[model samples]
Target: MADQTFDIEYVANLARLSLSDEEKQQLGSQLGQILDYIDQLNEVDVEGVEATAHPFPLVNVMRDDVIEGSLPHNEAMQNAPKKLNGLFQVPKIVE
Candidate 1:
């Protein structure tokens, strides 16, 4: 079922691209092979299989959120590159 009816020039034009002769030929062959593989996949039997977002069972691996004492503002700002008026001073990001 590897019947190829690909048109590389049509795709290139649609994408507003200028493909060389060699690139066009290569892309056509590659795209045809991809389509043939997809056709092969379409013939698979999955009557009892359920659609899934992931292949394996997913579980949250995060630790439980716990309230803890925060670092004091003075201590937190101690290592800052720039500090002013008891707060960390960062370069303004927005104009």
Candidate 2:
């Protein structure tokens, strides 16, 4: 219904895309059809319909926290690539 010829070249330039003449023509037609579909949807009557955030109901299926066995410092550092003074020695990130 609306003016079908959208500026395909301008849109392509904005998006930093290089489109051939055929591609541009194809995209222009596709975009026009999409806009027409949206215009059609605007004619629908839904005065009392409630807006839904999600299609399905969401429930927090979380489990209660529980403590687990703790490992000793020596045992924890056993497989470490490098350790010094009871701590892992990682490469310095900040100057």
Candidate 3:
């Protein structure tokens, strides 16, 4: 932050921007002010602080799987639209 200056023309070229003289002067002052605030932030001490990817701790949100008895074969086939022998009779899928 010591003796820093915003190179308006150079930055404009890097960003592929075409700025007028008035616009360049206005933007240069604005960029300088933004950098001044960042320079002030650099004065803060962050000793022994751990960096985190997220603000809160991530956890597995899935519920535990519960094993339960399945319906009997006769009960399962009871609601079938079509049944043959003891199983559901589905339409032919292959020619």
Clashes of each: 0, 0, 0
- Give all TM-scores, in the order shown: 0.40, 0.41, 0.44
* Tens digits of lDDT, candidate 2, 48-83: 988788899678978769887799889999999889
Please, what are the lDDT tens digits per residue for candidate 1 over residues 1-95?
65586677787899999999999888888888898878876688989989898789768878679988999888887888888899778889999
Q: Model 2, stretches more than 4 Å misplaced? A: 44-95
Task: Give the lDDT of residue 21 in candidate 3.
Answer: 100
TM-score of candidate 2 on Cα atoms, chains taken together: 0.41
Give the winner by TM-score: 1 or 2: 2
**Residue lDDT tens for model 3, 8-68:** 8898999999999999988888887778777876778978878897889778878769888
State model 2's lDDT: 0.88
Off by over 4 Å in 1: 1-3, 44-95
Q: How far is candidate 1 from the true structure (C-alpha RMSD, Å)?
A: 10.4
Assess candidate 3 and give its lDDT. 0.83
lDDT of each: 0.83, 0.88, 0.83
Model 3, residue 74: displacement in angstroms? Answer: 55
**Candidate 3: clashing pairs of residues:** none
Write down the lDDT that model 1 would get.
0.83
